[model samples]
Target: MSMAGDGREPLPHGPDPEVNHSSIGSTSPERDPLTSLMEIRGSLMVFATVMASVTYRAGLNPPGGFWTDNIDGHKAGTPVFQDVYCTRYKIFHYFNTSSFMMSLFILLFAIKASINNSDITKIMLHLTVLMDVITLIVSYIVGAYEDFQSSTYALVLMLMVFIYLVLEATTLIVRLCKAIRQMAYVLAKI
Candidate 1:
């Protein structure tokens, strides 16, 4: 694509920014992937925190499981909301909780990678992908234990998480490739 009006040759870094000023500051020549990744990580962190809380909390106090614990015990009667069968199924609460914790640690590494642009970022990226795979397995295991409806929901949510991690990995790879190509061009020019 022609980048300039005259079409002589596009600058290695693309067109000059006549006057650039934004909240993110000027886009560095490197086109650092971290800048965008930071925003995604921030949003994901908040979401994962809430999801984790709900995952563990819902296991203990599900909306469907709402019931008043009768201090009077069986002497009184079965509570109005107590379902003997509903409470039988146990959700794999730990999986989601652990997934949440892992996500946070990954976020920390993501932030570090974003800011520092070091080799450690690659390790963290691979870990993030691995965690996603583990979470998917956990969801299937939970499905084996949970009720049909709940199991479906859990699988769907885990699928979403898996897709998100994969997309992030792909984005980082593409951005890194672009940056490397630009750098190679610059080095050749020098």
Candidate 2:
């Protein structure tokens, strides 16, 4: 029984209506199988993106891929398209690949920070999201302006990949934002 102000009588025994076993948003009744599947799909997409970017950046890719560098200590083999004069495609590829790899690092850090619920993780996650958007923009520009340096099929494929990456990154950003909001709600409740 709760303490009474006047000590006249004790309150009746009953379950607390406000009692909750889980934190705020931990028991979302709206979550369905489809949403769960989508979350898993998003995670897989992110993993695939990271893997693809890493493979290309590491130079373990097909000929004429992102690893077509020919400069000393740049890439082991000879240049893929013989365009080693550092044109738009070369510069774009370099920056785009570097950005992609850096994004992977930020994402991994963000994941760790999110798990720990650290304030710094929130900031890092925000930065990662912003970086993702920037990368998307840069990638699109590369596709639009630089893709023409190659054949029509290659350019179209490049644009398509960038579009998919942007869309996936956008969705992931929204999901993470929602997660942060839920964390905020839980903190406020506590």
Candidate 3:
């Protein structure tokens, strides 16, 4: 007959017929966000592993292959592409190595995040993933295309992706700022 201890008065009819008590505090296993995110992290780790392998292979066996013999002052082990297209090869290697390093960093942070679930690890995972994507795109653009026309197409694609990513990041930042401002306003009112 008394009111609920920490809440509103008891329902007039003893209990609300519409209330679903079983679902109030229990979360469904299938729809849990942490589980979903963990699955996604696993997939990301696999992707990063593949990317690392690919970049490493690309570094070893470039598009133009390698010098077979020590001839014309070119070492047998040196990349032929590096000799033929010095500038392009330098740019390609730089981006490729960057992508490889980023992939490793992403894998490391993702694993750490999976284990610890700390905010710093989460932030690092996001940042490394972002940088890895960017560097991978750049490496492909610089290394994959054989001609100017193909490179042009890749450049256009890169530009579109870059713009979309920038817009998404800007929107996220704006929303975060708005949420902080709203929270401050609410606290001030209190």
Task: Estimate the TM-score of every prediction.
Answer: 0.39, 0.38, 0.64
lDDT of 1 by residue, 57-129 (tens): 6445533344445454432333222343333333334455556566666556544543644434554555564
Report the alpha-carbon TM-score of model 1 versus the true structure.
Answer: 0.39
Each prediction's RMSD over C-alphas, in Å, is 11.3, 13.7, 10.5
Which sections of candidate 3 miss by over 4 Å?
Answer: 1-37, 113-120, 168-190
Residue by residue across 1-190, what tens digits does model 3's lDDT show?
5655866665476557788666555655444445544766778889899989989999888878989999889999888888888888888899899989988876775576535443334444555666677777777776777687757866897889977766765665666566667778989999
> What lDDT would each prediction earn against the true structure?
0.54, 0.53, 0.74
Q: Look at candidate 3 and tell me the lDDT of residue 49.
A: 98
Look at candidate 3 and tell me the lDDT of residue 17.
71
Sort order, TM-score high to low: 3, 1, 2
lDDT of 2 by residue, 9-108 (tens): 7755766667764534453664442343333445635753664475355334422544445455566454443244346445556655655666666545
Kindly report which residue stretches of model 2 are placed more than 4 angstroms away from their true locations once superposed: 1-23, 26-77, 80-85, 110-116, 143-190
